[model samples]
Target: MSISERISALVGPASFVVAGGLSVAVAIFAAITIERRTIEDVETVLAADGIDWVLVSANGLQVFLDGTAPNEVARFRAQTGASAIIDPDRVINRLDVAAADTAAPPRFSLDLLRNGDGIQLIGLIPGPGGDEAFAIAEAIADIAGEAEVVNMIESAELAAPETWDAALAYGLRALETLPRSKVTVFADRVEVEAVGETREQRAEFIAQLQQDQPEGVEVVLDISAPRPVITPFTLRFVRDAEGGRFETCTADTAPARDRIVAAGLAAGATGVIPCTIGLGVPSPSWGEAVETALEALARLGQGTVTFSDADVTLIAAQGTAQVDFDTVVGELDADLPDVFSLQAILPEPETLASTGPARFTATFDAEDGARLRGRLPPGSIGQSVQTYASALFGADATDIATREVADLPQGWSVRVMAGLTALSELNDGQLVVEPDLLRLTGNTGDTELVSRLTRLLTEELGPGENYDLDVRYVEALDPVASQPTPEQCESRIRAIQEETKITFDPGSTEINDTAGEVLDAIAEVLPDCLHVRMEIGGHTDAQGGEGMNLNLSQRRADAVLNGLLARGVLVTNLTAQGYGESQPIASNDDEDGREQNRRIEFRLLASAEVAAAAGDIDDQPRTRGGILAQGEIADWPFEIRPLPRPINPDGE
Candidate 1:
């Protein structure tokens, strides 16, 4: 073979080999590029969909996803999201879903706070029953009409424990009864905190809760009733021929009570005289003031001492030597605390009247009520006398048919008021007020009445003033026999009204003459119920303008009060309020309902409110015998004060 021919053959073969090698290199480069692009695309898709937990890798056209996903849902989501950027067949899911966590169930509890502002519920409740968790809130809203319900509760998708329902129910019941309270409920326990208006109410609340406590659940109840506030704290002490006693005594603290009681005992007060320890002392020197007053009374030998907050009143017995009264009163006035003002009275002997020494008399019995047949100075004083007597006894229980005498003594009103006040201490009593003397004969359930009466008379009349007491202590004549509970008094009044309505003239406040008998019956009941404070509510149909109806109701209520006053009922503790159509028990849509709506009702005042009102009434200063001076007792210097000096023990 020639060289050219060999070269030609070699070239053809070599070319074929080179060309094949080039083709192989290109294919290898293209495969590497395709793998890189595929991996980049898969990663971009997974990253865009927040599937970072999934690790992405691709071999040629096949994509693999691997990583621990938080949950099956998350894993599935990542797979679906990644597949959207590529063919589903090309995507391989090697991602492992995290093992299902063994989580503990959530603890559940509920707290309920109820007050004047309404009810609030907070805490977690077992669920899917979200609506059921609000059942308590809904129930309170329904019962308390327009009461706000604040719900900050969350419900878990879990079943409530078996004990949860019972505990919750019990807590809800407690909440319903306790207006001012907090109730916490758990599966195994219920805690209730409440405040009551009085100790009795607190006891009732505890008893009710304990009685109705749920079985198999622990219950914790905390109910509190605070001490009542005393206004114009009163202390009355007397030492006479019968020895000494307290009619009413109040102290600010236990130590103060002890001090006051000891001083009273030292001054001749006998028996276990109870001194009320309560709030509201005019000054920290209350004990000192009382002690000084008692000392003065002791020095005077026979007298009464009264403390109305910072004011002190001392009355010397009429027979006390002028020098003795002057010395004691002057010393007491000077020695008393600065906060106290003293009024020392030395009564003058009364002149005899042609008509039995210008007498005033009051008689009381449980069955027949009270009768006031007395001579009062002609004027509004007569009306005042009736009103005063009624306040102490009860309007319905008293009858006043007194003739006004023109010439009653100067201190006659004081004597009358003092006698009536003392008589009220007895269950059944008769008091006679003469110009120069006061005589009381009564049966009392209170063993301490005679002593108290003796003290009151001495204080109001004068130390050593002529007064006689034939009062007897009889269990049957206890005040409880005459004085009914507030509820019972209201019930008795209701029964009387139910039997015969207290009718008035059509569209007028004038009570019909026929209602006189009803008024009289109510008056009889009032005397026995004098201690109870009450409201006489007047209501009218919604036929007239709102303002007119209100005015009409007020007038009617006032008329009723005036009628009771005329019947000799005490109106001090009784108040008249006109509601108009504001608080109607029956509908005004029909005649019968309207008639029912236009009726009078008797309601009991809360004990606290009654105390407040009573205090206001009793706060008025009673300058009976005479007001020796006002302001600081020490200001009245002995040199200037007009008190008689004694000539000698034998010579006046």
Candidate 2:
């Protein structure tokens, strides 16, 4: 029946005015009857449709719903049922739809791209203290120079992330490191696409971005710097008694450079950079030529290869086989790119009687007299060297044993003088010079000295001489190794780690600033413990899903490992392992217990030098087939240390 007809039967028609004519008893009875009928009809429809959570009411002909509905669909269903039984205009739905269950926040991100002309901010960023816009503008202004700013950013009013401040700070800070970059900033992830001015700068920037980012920020970096203009396209490297060095570095591309550097590293070259890939590259075949040339140089093992554009000079050391050198040089000459020409200058082997490359050797202690030995070319060149040495070592504190030699290589005097100058920078180290060879051995406290001198020597000695720096870093001497026993190493690590636990921000893998200090201390001691096998283990409490916790734990473990590597820990000695809720040490039912379980551990896996120093934990050696098994510890920095004899307490 229509609501009007039902009301008419119960009380009266809509046209009937009850203000003065209707009795109170009659109206009350009508309201009660209509309400009962409405409730019954609503319940019947709700049951048929499988919808619930709505209460029906009636005031005379008007019907009302007053209860919480599971959702909008349920509220609509109840209203539809009442409208069928009564006038549609008189049916009212007061049912409240239940609020939605909270879910994880979306990854908030935006990319701010700046170029030569102007700046364009793109992506979504949450308002942080309402200062994000200003921060972005200021950071861009600092780097944009005179370029105009274009704001294309859109923001939303959402809950701020716990690490938004840190993430924003880091992203803004990148503006200084990266002159031109497309920085994508998310609440948890920060990605950068940038260009560096030089290879060194590029590498340093990448290292800084990846290492020890604040807690709750995942860093993704792609930084590249083009190869600079190499005029004459010069190149030189030597391997001899003095050690090996590159007079200058050249690489047409990063991959080419990396391959070249890898070859050098394999051949024991340290602190060397390959050629950049920009201006003055003779041809696209530059990398190929470098690869073949480096192979040949590695084979020679003791010579200098200088390639200035097409002219390639191959100078062999004393015992280099003439036939082998000629064969390799011939192949290179024939196969080199059409734009390049090979000039193989193979000198006859040196005899003892022949005055070889001017020799310069200085042996001096800080407090005692010094001995300057070896030969220099004749005339003013020789005199200038003597004068420089005298001034450097002191006239009365020095004894000169060098003489003018015949037919020394051109600029031999300059190299000798430069060698002497470089030697003076060392506190107490030996510097030796030979034809195409310069070997430096000494101890210094300055870690920066190695890199500085590396570049300095390359510039002074012409980018084609062989140089070896055996300069030991003495930590006592502000600079920098002995292989300490594994026990001593592991104990030292644990001592620094015991008081502080490596914990991550809530649901984040980033290590906070405070935890980085502990990591720094760990890095300092890892050099001594290179012989020890260590595992960086991550664990979690059973709260979230098993898969999620496992993934989180794994990511956190990797983050810690990356952190240690950033702090200068040897990568070979460390392994990152994540054991999620599977290896919890405490109950997951309580917050404190869960916190205990959500921790990172630095555990000693195994070590060769076990008995040298007894640590708090008595770890027994696990041998396989009566020998040290090829396990995880033997991966890198491998060593077989003799177990030092244990001394009796009474000195027996």
Number of the top TM-score candidate: 2
In model 1, state the lDDT of residue 199.
59
Candidate 1, RMSD to the unseen true structure: 25.3
Query: What local distance difference test score does each model get?
Result: 0.74, 0.67
Q: Could you estimate the TM-score for every candidate?
A: 0.41, 0.45
Query: For this target, which candidate reaches the highest lDDT against the unseen true structure?
Result: 1
| Backbone clashes under 3 angstroms, per model | 14, 14
Q: Which stretches of candidate 1 lie over 4 Å from their true place?
A: 1-110, 123-145, 152-171, 184-233, 239-245, 251-281, 291-303, 316-334, 345-356, 365-369, 374-407, 413-429, 436-652
Per residue, candidate 1 scores C-alpha lDDT tens digits across 143-236 of 3556888888889889877677667766766776688999998988999999999856786677556643556789999998876676656677
Writing each residue's lDDT as its tens digit, candidate 2 over 1-652 gives: 9989787786754335564456766778887987787778867877788766666777767778888887787778788877776779988778888997777666677777766677787776676454455545654565465788787776666765777655665565464456678887777777889998887678667755553365767878889787566666656666666666664566667686787677667655777453445567677777777667767777766777666666566666667677887787777677766776666656555677554445678776666756788788788878888888899989998788887887787777777777777777777888888775678888777655665566566667754555666676687665212345555666787788677877778898888986798888888888766656676777889897766776777688889889988886777866676656766677889999998998887765433222112231122222110111211222112222222222222222
Model 1's TM-score against the true structure: 0.41
Residue 71, candidate 1: how far off, in angstroms?
A: 36
Cα error of candidate 1 at position 182, Å: 2.7
Error of 1 at 91 (Å): 61
